[model samples]
Target: MTQTPPEDAPTDAQSTFSGTREVDPRYALDEASLGVWLTANVEGYAGPLTVRQFKGGQSNPTYELSTPGRTYVLRRKPPGTLLPSAHAVDREFTVISALHAQGYPVAKPWALCTDDGVIGSMFYVMDKVEGRVLWDLKLPGMAPAERRAVYNAQVDTLAALHRFDPAAIGLGDYGKPGNYFERQVGRWTKQYRASEIDPIPAMDRLIDFLPATLPPEGPTRIVHGDFRLDNMILAPDQAQVRAVLDWELSTLGDPLADFSYLLIAWAIPGSLRNGLAGADLKALGIPSVEEVVARYSEKTGAPAPSNLDWLFAYNLFRLAAICQGIAGRVRDGTAASPQAKSMAAQVPALAEGAWSFAKKAGA
Candidate 1:
């Protein structure tokens, strides 16, 4: 099998350059190498093209590709080491294509190359959506007139995802819904065990508490596994959301899980980062958790759950667990960021926050 080049792969203590830092026999295609794959699959105008990689996101590496007369974004599974079925290339394309047809703002995919001969794995091309995807949007800097509108727009966008019906769209089998919270608890617990090179007592205890503390009932809808301002494109001309980006983790399950994730980050923007620099949480202008829950209630007709504390704690635990996974790969030589060295330190506060939310979760 051929391999894709690791443009962002982290080298061992190399002066400067970083990677997710895991080693897998599976390879990623670099620009020069990917050009060969493009030649065989994507046909339009050929010749040298310009490609610039977009940074951000916990998974997948995306790039803005430009030829003399064309513009596109390439989406491929992250190369190097990874877990099985976790990066379903076809599932990603299918959901996005379905969402596009449903009038949900999403970049339209033009082609998919599944031939292993092409680039060692399946990859696809889609038209790149225009606008800014600011992770740390500055709320204080915006004109006051548009601030509330933008915040409402963000709320409206999440509300729209909850509005989506997978059955109506012919995606009934998108994701399994059996034991949703239990499975999450089990999975993270396993990840913690696999990465427990150091001690994390509270994480262990929180894992034990999750299954029992889950929301009283599960509400199913299309979940955007990871939803945030950075993954969304705000139309430059309007306060409305132009498109929802990054559906790789999307599935058919508890839509509330998604809402919970957003609320976790939304309620305390900088609070979650634990003194991480370059995170100006206020610029994004995330609505208050109450605003978000209330708007979602108004639009979706499902009132926010009476016991929100449990959900909040669960969300914090999941985020911290995810970072723990990142820290594990860093230690295992899969992640190459020096920042990974400090990431494991985040667990204690993260666990504490989880417990804190637990206290208020039923509210």
Candidate 2:
């Protein structure tokens, strides 16, 4: 019999951005236009630029910008019709800029371009952080001790983020305070309806069940809406996180809710695509989901919430909705990555997972 992967294991594909492919034609930027914009807006920019798209992200079209002196990363909104407030590149720039200014491990902000005439969509440029971006939650190819350290570092970073005062950091208005779960559930529900293609009964159940089971409001902090191991760039030789990438979904929300969302990776099994559910965690020496939560609570000095299971179910519901949206985009020819179809294919399984946890909420 195979030992199961711990329920709290992080889940992401093991990959690198080193082998960036030619820019997808639909999302391509005119180098001349981009060069002109950079020259005008970005400082110290002298460029005969080369551009290639990174392979990892599922939402935004991320590209590597090469200049004679240095390389930068460009994140742009996907071209085509979009649902309201979906691809908010401007918001991404704002959150990352604010965090970087306060010595947070985020990519250094360079400039934000809103003139759609230049790139066909809103976009931003930031320093290209050089580090190991381990896509696999298991930290494949690493020693067990190194894997443990990496996981600890990830949790520590998350705690540090929650501990910061968003107001003092100029992010007080980043998102509405309080009732975050309510707002998020409403938002994703609308998004799901807008992009609905297939009928998912579990998703329907969640849309109805979540509101009826609302927990007491928790404290708000700036939540990295899509926090996970792959969303961070780790130090090349050590377990330290160099920069947290992808702020497209960052906002003010219940910190425990955000942390609970991270814990979903553990609930996902390794047998499933983009899941780590069935891997052998004991041999890998990865901590269980319970241990990870305990560590976070200890580090942040916040007790775990009484309705923690409910929050987990809510997060699972949100993720399934997100994947459903991706499926819609794929069907409509607006998906950013080719892998969107595969990701979308997992929506039913995700919905079932959400329903399973929802049932367990009161047990």
Steric clashes per prediction: 21, 9
The 0-to-1 C-alpha lDDT of every candidate, in the order given, reads 0.64, 0.81
Whole-structure CA lDDT of model 2: 0.81
Instruction: Report how far off residue 171 is in candidate 1 (Å).
Output: 1.3
Report the C-alpha lDDT of model 1 over 1-363, residue by residue, as the tens digit: 011112233332122221122222323455666677677666674648676655443445555677877788876665556644455667778888888898887888777777756555667888877775544333435765566677678778888878877888877788776567777677767766666667777677787678766655566688887776556788877787888877876788777777777665544534222111234334544455676788888988887777667877887787677667666666666542335445556667677878787767542
The 10 consecutive residues of candidate 1 with the worst lDDT sum are: 1-10
Question: Could you tell me the lDDT of residue 167 within candidate 1?
Answer: 84
Per-prediction TM-score to the true structure, in the order listed: 0.81, 0.94
Expressed as tens digits, the lDDT of each residue in 56-139 for candidate 2 is: 776789999988899999999888888888878899899998888888899999999998999898999999999887766666
Clashes of 1: 21
- After superposition, the stretches of candidate 2 with alpha carbons farther than 4 Å from their true spots are 1-18, 272-274
Off by over 4 Å in 1: 1-33, 43-45, 115-117, 137-140, 269-287, 336-345, 361-363
RMSD of each: 6.4, 4.1
